[model samples]
Target: MTIEGRHVVILSGGISHERDVSLRSGRRVSDALIKAGARVTVREPDEKLLPWLEQHFEDVDVVWPVLHGVSGENGALYSLLRALEVPYVGSRPTAAMLAWNKATSKALVKRAGIATPQSIVLPNDTFRELGAASVIDAISKGVDFPAVVKPVEGGSSQGVSFVNEKAEFSRAMVTAFTYSDGVLIEKKVTGTELMVGVLDFGEGPFAVPPVEVVPHSGVYDYAARYNAGETTFFAPARVSEAVLAEVSELAVKACQVIGLADVARVDFIVDESGKPWFIEADPIPGMTETSLVPLGIQAAGLEVSDVYARLAEHAAARGPRNTPATPNLVV
Candidate 1:
């Protein structure tokens, strides 16, 4: 299957916090698809976007949504796309919703026998009713020091904080709640941080080379993630071959457990003992200049344009979600 001359409408730049990142990702994807000879159109998910898509659906072949935050990853837009009978790249609606919430994805992966960090989910309403002092005290006692506090659902490390002591808990909670209605306090796993991208182009899913992330600030937050010089990345990661294999396998397993399709990225922390601990799974990973998935793709000796093109072709082959499938069709 080829995407040459096919029309690809990339949805990006929603009103989410990650709008800038989404635009960067969308531009990169559009350029890559165009390089593969596909006609590309970049559109923002605004008030008029749905009507525009509905009216121009026939002119579009596949929609590659590079949206990042709640507007994109929460599954609402994907559901509308499905309802409009439009084919798009990435995970399905249910899968996107499941993966959007960090706590839920961690629970699902853990249930699949994966090793995820122990954590507690506290909604803002519950935190308010429980009294700030009591909830903070309980969290400090329950989770070890140097814990990770983040919004229950978000990306780009926008509202993530690391608390090294009890006093920092209050500030961390405040920061997390700024981005989401809930917060997840997780035990910090110390070790090498690796991001593995799982991609499927018609065939079964497979893992790309793992990319090791080393941020100068000792944390891979929003600044380190988007700023090129703030962090150092090692494609294929600088770990033992055995550890690399384990990480790859775990990445694929995590995506499968979360029902992520087309393409996704699974993050892990490989402790000194060579055990990989699942951190979180990204349903729609950033395709910016400093993004890890692109590094992994290049490290695997594959061209980015080709991979994006193949994914678009695969989605187009599947056609609209509402279409009836042939008997014994391999999906």
Candidate 2:
């Protein structure tokens, strides 16, 4: 199967905090697909999206959703796409839902023997009922200091804060709650930050070269992530061959365990001991100019256009979800 001459609809620009990033990512993917000889259409996830898709379903060979944040990663949009029997380039709805919640994904990957930082999930209601100060005091006593506070479900590092002391915990929690109903307070693992992209091109999933993220501000927040020059990325990460191999394997394993298909990105924090601790998984990774996935792709001697196009071809070949292998065969 090939994406050549295929009509691909790229969904981007949802009503989320990451809308601008999503739009940039969608444009990048659109250009890549167009370069690969596919006809591309860029659309936002708006009120008329469903009706438009229904009207042009036959014309769309694949639906590549480049949406970030809850509008894309929480699995609601993917479920709707599935109901419409659309072939899409990304994880299944269930998988996406599992990966969207950092706490849930951490628990799952840890159970599978993947090392993840210890964390606690605190709902906004918990603070409202138990008292914010009381809850923060409890958390400070239970978890280690210098923790990472973030929304349980989000992307582009929005509403994420790094707290170096007990005093900062309260403010961090408040910022996190701004993006989600619940906040995940994780033990901030100190070391190199690496992002590996897992892609499946019909055969099996493989990890792209890991990209080492070094934020100029010492924090990979929303600005550091999307703004060029805010962070420096070292493709194929400056690590030993053995550590690089381990990170790659773990990236692929994390995605497989979470049931992510087509494309994904697994982040890790490697400590001084060289142990890689799983951070989180992105079911729909960013494809923007400064995104890690594209950097890894280029470092691996692969063209972004080829990789994106191949993903579309693979999704098209798989067809709609739950479709029987033999059309006439009765279950």
Candidate 3:
């Protein structure tokens, strides 16, 4: 459908560690909407963002939030958008919040019959109150080595660590706590790491071709994620046809189970047995040039601009879902 004359406010650049990344994504999204014949505004959310929404509420057709990290993916901004009754692209506030926290999202994904790695959630106070040494001792017994430690919420692989030994686990915990109060430590699933993007333009959600991530450092951290070149990505994931189909199916199922909307990028680690284990889901996946969503879009023979335009059109069609939101929307 033609999105001509559709007024879209592309919200990006929040006060988060991923601000730079979010701005780039917002610019790309704005350019795409403009190219698709829509009136676009690239906005950096600030104190005035809510007031601006209130004033121009009638003129705005959709708000495409590209904020990353805690500011964007945490769902606070989505709650505000809903309160303002402004249609926006991406998942609902509740879904976004649920998916924002890696621990909660993994639980839901597992509950949906998807295999996820064995993991544990630790709050900062657990370490402080129970004593760091005690907590570490418990973790050592619970999760196996060659584990992954990361903040419960945030993106771009920031504050993520690969712990090959118990001795190095403390540093990983400290790194994760630097980003968020809660940390998710998982027994690193051994297999092919794949990023599967799912989108529903208007029809029911389906998976785009999976993108396999191979980092030269052997760890896909923040540096490998944004610096480009440090990682080699395989568009069709170099997996067998059956594996590809299974990965795609799992991605779609995860989206449905998580209640994600418009689009979502589900990360997975496919074991040697060919089973795709869900790692996490991004309700607001990145849109930067080096981002995986664009790669998935290209692999599916679709352009970024077209996909984004379709999302905006769908948001306009549905309008905003009006509901009062509390401080916590996870439940």
> Please, what is the whole-model Cα lDDT of each candidate in the order they appear?
0.91, 0.90, 0.87
TM-score of 2: 0.96
What TM-score does each of the candidates earn?
0.96, 0.96, 0.95
Candidate 3 — what's its lDDT? 0.87
Q: Put down candidate 2 lDDT per residue, 1-331, tens digits, no spaces.
A: 7899999999999999999999999999999999999999999999999999899988989899999999999889988998999888887787888899898788778878999998889999999999999999999987897899999999889898988888998889889989999999999999999999998986889999999999999889888998989999999899999999999999988887788888899999999999999999999999899999999999999999999999899888887593212112111
Cα-lDDT of candidate 2: 0.90
- Candidate 1 global lDDT: 0.91
Ten contiguous residues minimizing lDDT sum, candidate 2:
322-331
After TM-score superposition, the amount by which residue 204's alpha carbon in candidate 1 deviates from its true location, in angstroms, is 0.6
Q: Which ten residues in a row have the lowest lDDT in candidate 3?
A: 322-331
Alpha-carbon runs more than 4 Å astray in model 2: 322-331
User: Who is ahead in TM-score, 1 or 3?
Assistant: 1
Which residue pairs clash within candidate 2?
none
Error of 2 at 65 (Å): 0.3
lDDT of 3 by residue, 1-331 (tens): 4688889999999889999889888888888889989999888889988999899988989999998988888888888888888888878788888889888888877776888999999999999999998899899889998899999988889999998887888999999999999999999888999999999876788899999999999888877888869999999899999999998999988787777888889999999888888999998898887789889999999988888889899888877783222223232
Per candidate, the number of residue pairs that clash is 0, 0, 0
Model 3: lDDT of residue 54: 93
Per-residue lDDT of model 1, residues 1-331, tens digit only: 6899999999999999999999999999999999999999999888988899889978989999999999999888888988898999977787888889999899888888899998999999987798999999998899987899999999999999999999999899999999999999999999999999999986778999999999999999999999879999999899999999999999988888788888999999999898999999999999999999999999999999999999999998886572222122111
Candidates ranked by lDDT: 1, 2, 3
- Candidate 3: regions farther than 4 A off: 322-331
